[model samples]
Target: MKKELTADSAAAAARHARYGTLPERIRFEDMTEEVESAPGGAAASYDPEGSWKSYSCLALDLGL
Candidate 1:
């Protein structure tokens, strides 16, 4: 049986068709383009406790 193609798999196939594949060895210097970073030190001093809030148990509600 043939497997179904997911959205991610389809996108990956399209990308592979367009750009082929990556080289065996990727260098850090090749990816040294300066892109826009997070505002100041927001990423450095991120409060994970405040961000990752607990969610309701969906599995229990669905009786799984």
Candidate 2:
């Protein structure tokens, strides 16, 4: 009799195939994360001149 694979089992098999098995001591649920947001907000924090200067191109083409 062939046993049908469940969604969770299929995902677990694929994950093991890609990354191999992880150590038992590591669990994602036990982890804590901290994130800090920009005080001026994302759009207000943009430096257009600084960004454009970083790009290496003979001309800035927008394809317009």
Candidate 3:
């Protein structure tokens, strides 16, 4: 069967492509310049804890 795609699914796919699996943490220095240049830019502080959560929450809020 062919799977249908929705906005949420597309968002999740894009997220996975960019960051791998959920709850995956990424560092500012690790991100590409284009991504870092986008709105909000990179994390100001380098807190290893909960950074993935923050990114996921923000992504959801922004509707991907």
Candidate 4:
């Protein structure tokens, strides 16, 4: 008898071929409204180069 291939089985085989194991951990985090709005606020008023540095430093300060 010929066996039929399945989407789930194909995906699992591909993962094992690439990584030697299936992925086991997954996590998700929500972005806050304030964080989403800050970039637009900064870009409107500040130079682009300086704004990115300032933003990166702010993120580091917050340990994000």
Clashing pairs in 1: none
Residue range with the least summed lDDT across 10 consecutive positions in model 1: 47-56
How many pairs collide in each candidate, listed in order?
A: 0, 0, 0, 0
lDDT of 3 by residue, 1-64 (tens): 9999999999999998998966769998788665346554466656788667656466778888
lDDT of 3: 0.77
Against the true structure, candidate 3 reaches a TM-score of: 0.32
> Which lDDT value does model 3 have at 44?
61
The top-ranked prediction according to TM-score is 1
Runs in model 4 deviating more than 4 A are: 22-64
* Best of the two (2, 3) by TM-score: 2
Q: Per-residue lDDT tens digits of candidate 1, residues 1-64? A: 9999999999999999999988788689986888887676667777778764555678966989
Model 2: per-residue Cα lDDT over 1-64, one tens digit each: 9999999999989999999976789568669777898787988968987996677664545543
After superposition, the stretches of candidate 2 with alpha carbons farther than 4 Å from their true spots are 23-64
**What lDDT score is found at residue 3 in candidate 1?**
100
| Candidate-wise lDDT, in order | 0.83, 0.82, 0.77, 0.69
Candidate order by TM-score, highest to lowest?
1, 2, 3, 4
Model 4's alpha-carbon lDDT is 0.69
